[model samples]
Every structure is written in structure tokens, then in C-alpha cells.
Target: MAVLEATNPAFEQFVRDTVLNMPAARHLGFEFGRIAPGDVEIIQPYREELTQHDGFVQGGVLGSLADFAAGCAAGTLLPPGWVNMTIDYTVKILAPAKGEKLVARGRVVKAGPVMTVAAADVYSADGAEETLCATAFVTMRNIRAARS
Candidate 1:
């Protein structure tokens, strides 16, 4: 995989301040694994509350992880003071997310002035093994942040 570096020197901090600080992300305990231009990785530690009756991580949780990772990846490519919002996303759960943690790797497919397309692959990590659990494609609308 080609690694893309962010033009913004503070992009990592920007992601932490905007993405990781969101209420839902904070509540779900999502953390940054990696953040770069057009790429990102988010980690969600396994929690009992996030699991379904069968003890596997819920589909909704997986979808949320994929969405956040992809959106953040798109955000990394935005110009300074710009942000991206998820307009649409589709997630497919392929396996039971039974593991110690979940890692979502997201990469931008294409970026434009007003829109960006991204994709994410979610994996369930158990010790040294990782299983592909879900995948997602996301579309984001790029917009300038409104001054407060």
C-alpha cells in the first residue's frame, strides 16, 4: 500500500480534535491507529455493550467504525479549515467480529472539490490473527467549516 502524507502538519491533531472527540466516538472508545493524507485507521476495543446477543460485535457498530474511518480518511485530504461529511455509505458484514479489538482501515478512492469517495475494510484482531469482518464504501461531501 502506498502511504500518503498529509499536507497539513496538524492533520493528526485535527482528526483527534474533530473525529475522536465526537460524542459517539468518545462513547464507543474509538482511537486513532493511523492518520495520513487519504488514509486512516481507527481502532475500537472490544466491549461487552457493543456486542450482540451472540457475543459478536453488532453490525451497526461495525458500520459506524467503517463510516468514521472512511470519513476521516476523506477529511485528511481536505484543505485547511475544510471538513467532510458522510453523505452516504454502504457496509457489508462478512464475518462475526469476535476478537479483542476491531481495526478499520480506510483509504480515499477519489477526491474532488465538493465530494470524495472512500472505502474501508474492517478486521477483527485476535492476538496475532486478524479476520476480515466487514467492508464499506463511503461518499463524503466536502465543505468549509462555518466560523463560530
Candidate 2:
């Protein structure tokens, strides 16, 4: 696969701003990690409230992180002032997420004018080890945001 680079010089800032302004992302305390043209990483710190009965991170939270990460990856390839929204997504849980935090690595699979395909791998991170917990494939629709 060919490596993808960001066309927008302010892509990092754009993704940061977009994520920061989102209520769910903010509530989940999502942190920005790597931000590239066609790749992005989002980190979610573990909280008791976000865990399931067995103290593992909830599946819904994992899916949400994957969706956000994948959508942001596609958004990085969009033109300035353009944003992408998740039209559809599928996630598979492979293992229980038991760790200090979760890291989601997202990459664009294909980018087009109106739609984009992306995928993400979610990992449960301990002090120095990480375990793959989930994977997701996402489809996004690109749209120009209304200017204020």
C-alpha cells in the first residue's frame, strides 16, 4: 500500500479543533496523538465509568473511538473547510480491553471527492505493552462545513 500524506498544511489543527469541539469526544477525554494526511491516532484514557461489569472498557466506547479515529483520518484528506462524517461503520471486538488506556490508529483506505473509506485498529495499552482489542472499517461522506 502507498503511504498517504496530508495535503492541508493545517490538517493537524483542523483535526484537533474538530475533535475538541465535539461533545462526545470531549466527554470521553480523547487525546490527539499522531496526525498525518491519511492517518490519525486517538487516545482514550481508562476511567471506571467507562468500563463494563468485568472492568474492561465497554464495547460501545471502543466502537466510538474507532469511528472517530477513522473519520478523522478521512477528514485529513479533505480540502480545507471540508469535513467528513461517518456514514457507516463496522467494528469487531477481538479481545477484552484491560489496560490503562486505549489507543486507536486510523488510516484512510481510499479517498474520493464525496466519500472515503477508512479503517482503525484499537489497542489496549498497559505500561509498556499493548494488546489488539478491536478493529473497525468505516465509510465517510465528505461535506463542506457551513461558514460562520
Candidate 3:
């Protein structure tokens, strides 16, 4: 991903604060590791409660992590008072999610006033090894603050 700066100077703080306020993120124990313009990373520790009967991390948890990372990357390009929400999302689960933790890195491919496209790669990290577990492509629409 090309390094870019957000048009809104306070975007970094906004993104961080937004993530802190997201109930899904909080419930999933997602940690925002990096938040750069057009790029973001979210990490979550593996927990038995988040696993399925097969002992693999549930797909829903992975999907939520990817969506949050992708949406934040897209939001970095939006103006202040404007937010981006995912309109379309597609994910491909590549491998079993068996690891000590999960990390997702998302990057914005295209950012426009109306829509943005981003992709996230989810990895399963076990000790010192990290394996690709899933990939997601997300499209988001910008939402401006409503006029009173």
C-alpha cells in the first residue's frame, strides 16, 4: 500500500476513538495496532469462547475483525464529520483458524467521494509463525453528517 496522509488532520485520533467506541470491537477484544492513512491493522487474541465445535475460531469473529479493519482504512480518507460504512463485503477462508491470535491488515485500493474499496488479509499467528487464514474485499460508502 502506498503511504498517504489523511486530508483531515485529526483523522488518526478520530479513528482511534471510533474503534474504542465500537461495541463489536470491544466485545471481540480487538486491539488497534496501526492506524495510518489508508491502512489499518486489528488484532484479537484467540479464546475458547470464540471458537466453534471444531476448536477453530469461528468465521463470524474473523469476518467482524476484517470488516472493522477495512472500514477504518476507508474512513481514513473521508472528511471530518463523514463516516464510511461497508456496503459490500466478500471473504474467502483459506485455511483453518487455529492459532494463538488473529491479525488482519487492511489497505485501501481506491478512495472516492462516494465509495471506497479496500482489502484485508487475515492471518493466524501461532508462536512465531503466521499463516494466511482469510482474505476479504470490502466496498464502503461515505456518509456525511445530516443537515439539521
Candidate 4:
């Protein structure tokens, strides 16, 4: 993927602050890995609470991580006073998510004034080994941020 320039100059810092403070991301144990324009990475360590009965990570958790990463990637292109929200997200689980940690990497595929398309790949990382666990596609809609 070609490196895309960021429309928002403070996008990396913005993502760091916004994602770290998000309640759902925090509760789900998501930690920001890399935050750059049109690219984002999130990591979550395996925890019992985030697993299914078979000792694998829950699908919902992977979906949430993908959605979050994709949304953040799209946000980098938004103009000031604008925010993006996920309009559609689909995830395909390719493997059993058994690992010490899961890493989700997302990049914006296309960006426009009102809409953006992003894709993410989730991997299960156990020590030096990594496996593709899921792939996701997300569509985001840009809207004016509501004033508090």
C-alpha cells in the first residue's frame, strides 16, 4: 500500500488520546500499537474474559477490534470538525484465535469527502509465530461532530 498523507496534522496524537480513553476499547484490553495516517494497529492480549468456551478468542472481540481499527484509520483523513462512524463492517474468521495476543492492522483503502473504505487483518501472535485469524472490511461515513 502506498503511504497516504494525512489531512489532519495531529491525527496520530488524536487517535492515541481518543482510542486509549474509549471505554469499550479499554474494557476489551485493546492497546494502541502504531498510529499513522491511513494506518492503524491495535493489540489485545488473550484474557479469559475475552475468550469463548473452547479457549479461543471470541469472534465479537475480533470484530470489535477490526471495527475500531478501521474507524480510526478513516478518521485520519477527516477534516477538522468532522468525525467518522462505521456504517458497515464485516469480518471473516479464518482460524481459531488461540494465541498469547491478537494484533489487528488496518489501512484505508479509499477515502472521500463523505465516505471511506478500510480493511483490516487480524492475526494471532504466539511468541514468534503468527497466524491469520480474521479479515475485515469496513465502510465509514463522515459527519460533522456534534457540539457538546
Candidate 5:
């Protein structure tokens, strides 16, 4: 498997394209905040459809946000013809999810031929303030895309 070139981009356009392409999450309406090389930021609103009885953000939603951002971060570095897959991940929730929106910051710590590692943090976004809610580390597999 040759090193992937132009794998994916870690920017607003890349994120928009990918999210729009996804089926289930298409309605989530994620907003990419900081879309630069090797870095990605996003904001996801708190919606009743994505919450539990306690009215908190679902773990799955949080995980998806982390995964999406991490992938974008890794994509910025991956060569073309290659796509990234989440091989492993860990998350730690620090506080309850509250506020109108959740902010996520995901960035690539390391990008290699076989693997790409990324870290992300979720925060509660309020007026001129933010609070940490969760954090995650994701390791992704880098491989060539198959053509049928």
C-alpha cells in the first residue's frame, strides 16, 4: 500500500463535504470552527433529539463529533488516495454537557504512513465563556482506497 497522497483536507470545505455525505448525521448541522492544516474545530448544538432524559448530550453524539474532527485533522496530513479509519479511541468526560452548543477542538498529534493519532476536547460554549466537558484520543488506520 503506497502512502496516501491528498488523502483528505483538514479545513472547512473538507468537513462540510464529508458531513454532508454522511447519512444519519446529515441533520446534525455541525459547524467547523477552525479549519486549518492539521487542526479542526467544530460546534454542535444541543438538541433534544440527541439527548437523554437528563437533557444532556449523548455519549454517541460526543463520540461522533470527536471522530469527525479527529478524522479531519488526520486527513490534513494523509497523502492522496488514502482514507483514515478509527482503530482505537479513549474518552474522558469531565463535566456535564450544558449550554446552547458544544465546541470541539481536534488536532493531529502525529501523522504517519500506517497510522494517524489525534486528540480532541469537547467544551460547553456559552456567552463569552467555555467549559470542558470531555476529551478524547483517537488512533486511525491509514490505507489506500479500493476501486471496484
Candidate 6:
């Protein structure tokens, strides 16, 4: 994988490719389509791969997006070799996640040595149609991985 940077001209493109390459994320069609300093946003398609038996999106799918978005947002501020892992995570479901697509928006609320705190909000794609399907808080811990 390439080292990604928030300042990179292709920040969004880089993250989009990287996120889709994640095996777990690919299984559910979670696309990391955009990024900014301390922030990330993704589009999750409402497809059979992520739907529950009753036809609504599975909670696990939403949770995964929330986690990835939060992690990536926190990642934007780190140096090479300073990758983040989800040390703690929490989510609250507020509305039915039903639509052609859903968005997961994440921001790093705080960053410190060894750990970072982040939050996310899942919303519908359509305007005036914010369901606020979910909200997430994430804890990202830096690890001593090899620099990319």
C-alpha cells in the first residue's frame, strides 16, 4: 500500500483505492471516496451483500463503515509508521438505514501520543433526508508498523 497523506493532491483517490482494497471492506462495498484534514467520508451502497434478511442494511455494515471512516480520519494526522488501530468503538443507531446509498462521515475530535479520539455520523445521500442512521466514537492507537 502507498503512504497516504491528507496534503496529497490525490488524497481522496488514494483513500478510495486503499479502503476498497481492504478485504473486509470489499466484502461489503464500502467505498472511501473522499478525505480532508481530520476527516473522511464514505459511500456504502445498499446492496445484497450488506442487507439483512428483512431487506434493511445490516448493523455490522454500518459499524464497519463507521470504524473505517473514523480510523482514516485519525490517520490523516499521523506520520509514516504511525498507523491506527481501533482500541475502542461505540455506535448508536438513530434511524432506519434505507436508501440507494448511505454516507459515513468521520472526524478526529482529538489526537495525542499513542491514541486518538474520533467521531462519525452516518447519513443518507439525499438532501433533506438525513436519517442520522448512526453515530460513532472511535479510539485509534498508534502502533510501530513498518513505514509504507
RMSD of 3: 1.6
**Each candidate's clash count:** 0, 1, 0, 0, 8, 0
Residue-wise C-alpha lDDT for candidate 6, range 81-106, written one tens digit per residue: 45668999999988778788889999
Candidate 6 Cα misplacement greater than 4 A, ranges: 1-18, 126-128
- Which one is best on TM-score? 2
TM-score of each: 0.95, 0.97, 0.93, 0.95, 0.85, 0.83
- Cα lDDT for residue 145, model 4? 84
Query: What is candidate 6's CA lDDT for residue 15?
Result: 54
User: Which structure is stronger by lDDT: 4 or 6?
Assistant: 4
Query: Residue-wise lDDT of candidate 4 within 1-148, one digit each (tens)?
Result: 6778887788888777767787987899788888888999999999999999889999999899899889888888777678888899999999989899999999999998989999999999999899999999999999998999
RMSD of 2: 0.9
- Candidate 5 to native Cα RMSD, angstroms: 4.3
Report lDDT (Cα) of residue 34, candidate 2. Answer: 93
- Residue-level lDDT of model 3, residues 1-148, one tens digit each, is 5577799899888888877797877888878888899999988898999999888999987888788889999988889889888899999999989888999999898999999999999999988899999999999999995766
True lDDT of residue 101, candidate 1: 97
Model 1, span 1-148: residue lDDT tens: 6566676678878877898668899899989898888889999999999998878999999999999999999888877898889999999999999899999999999888899999999999999899999999999999989998
Which TM-score value belongs to model 5? 0.85
Task: Go through the candidates in order and give each one's C-alpha lDDT.
Answer: 0.91, 0.93, 0.88, 0.89, 0.78, 0.78
Return whichever of 1 and 4 wins on lDDT: 1
Q: Which is superior by lDDT, 1 or 6? A: 1
Give the clashing residue pairs of candidate 4, or none. none
Reference-based lDDT, residue 38, model 6: 80
Task: Decide which is better by lDDT, 1 or 2.
Answer: 2
Consecutive 10-residue window with the lowest summed lDDT within model 3: 1-10
